[model samples]
Target: MDDIHAPTVASGLSSGIAPRDVSKVSMPDLMQEKERIEAELSALSSVLNSHGVNMNSSLTTFDGFPRDDIDIAQVRTTRVRIIHLRNDHKAVMTHLEKGLHDHFARLQNAPGATSANGTTVPSSAPTSVTDNSIADTGTLGTPFARVNSVEPGSPAHQAGLKMGDSIRGFGSVHWLNHERLSKVAEAVQQNEGRPLTVKVTRKNESGSGTTELDLQLTPRRNWGGRGLLGCHIVPL
Candidate 1:
């Protein structure tokens, strides 16, 4: 974290660019913006760590007096900035998802055709739904783990994962192969920077029953949070 200077929270914790029409932006540009926000968030987290505090750490004692061990002023300011950056991160991810969807749509309508956004598709651009389909969603499998909490702006949140969602499958690690959740950790490690199909069952909006959902989650380090998924999971 010290390798990268912590951003000044007061200067604004946005992605360091003016808001533009996301539809008009190219997919690559959107991805770059996402990376930028994530890096800043990671740096901010390091700053908080240096101050010996976390988002949940109390800044005051039981008597409501400011604690003496840590910098209360800095901790409060950093917390606020992290909140703002998390919101910004979520917005950028939304735009990135839209860009990916639009990219795929254009490709389907015209195979190997130039992107509608007019930027030359990079050779490194992902080609398959399994690789980059953030919107490719469906339901399958049996429950193995349950999402107890989802952190805002974390990869789980970016992928539309929610609290109380029951994890039915995670990539190749299904209910049988999960090995008491160890395989889930292994899958996340092995698939860093690559999207993994996460199948989950959640209560329907109508509240009558449950429905399954498929989400593409990419895990990466230093996402300004504690874990790559920014979520807490427990075995069913």
Candidate 2:
């Protein structure tokens, strides 16, 4: 009886970064595969957070909900949930496709992605959720890392490093890669440990144009993590 209740699945396949389909499997297989997928996704929750879907868009906020679609007086929570997931499934598939493509593409680009040594290519490791201002985040015209959100007391935060500022030159190099900040810090002591200079650019609100600015910052002391600028930096 329990086996009869499993969702039917189709054959596993790929399409434009499509999520795996398991429709051909039996009830037990479906349950096992679903569990497997869920387990595989657990390590990347930060990158995989599925906020409630906004049917109105990936580019716009969902201005309204169809709450009134059902007669509230008779609708049950189970019914509401089922309906919501049904509506959200399409959107979920779209996002999944996009994510899978990105993930695989990155793997392909990684060193040794094609050969055993390919994946082992010598590369600057990525920065943690910490300081990344070491690299040249300065740019001649555009801002550096997409300023998703800036902290309240960090140097940039206090100096008016508002959200959306693209840091271009750190001390004198591009921080676009985002790992330079950490690399620069490791080399700072060798370079005299002076206060670092940064160049930042951001869009003009009026769309008139972009503007450039300069900032000076010293590394925070006793930082808990490598390359952390002692600021709360979140991805945009």
Q: Give the Cα lDDT of each candidate.
A: 0.71, 0.43
Per-candidate clash tally: 0, 32
CA shift of 139, model 2, Å? 8.2
Runs of candidate 2 with Cα error greater than 4 angstroms are: 1-144, 175-194, 222-236
Best by the lDDT measure: 1
**In candidate 2, what are the lDDT values of residues 76-115, reduced to their tens digit?**
2222333333433443434433433444457556765554
Scored against the true structure, residue 127 in model 2 reaches a CA lDDT of: 32
lDDT of 1 by residue, 1-236 (tens): 22112334556544455555555667667656555666677788999999887888766678766678887667777777788767766776666655555665555467465656976654444433223232232311557789999999999999989999999778876643354577799989899999998988899989899887789999988889987789998977
TM-score of 2: 0.32
Model 1: lDDT equals 0.71
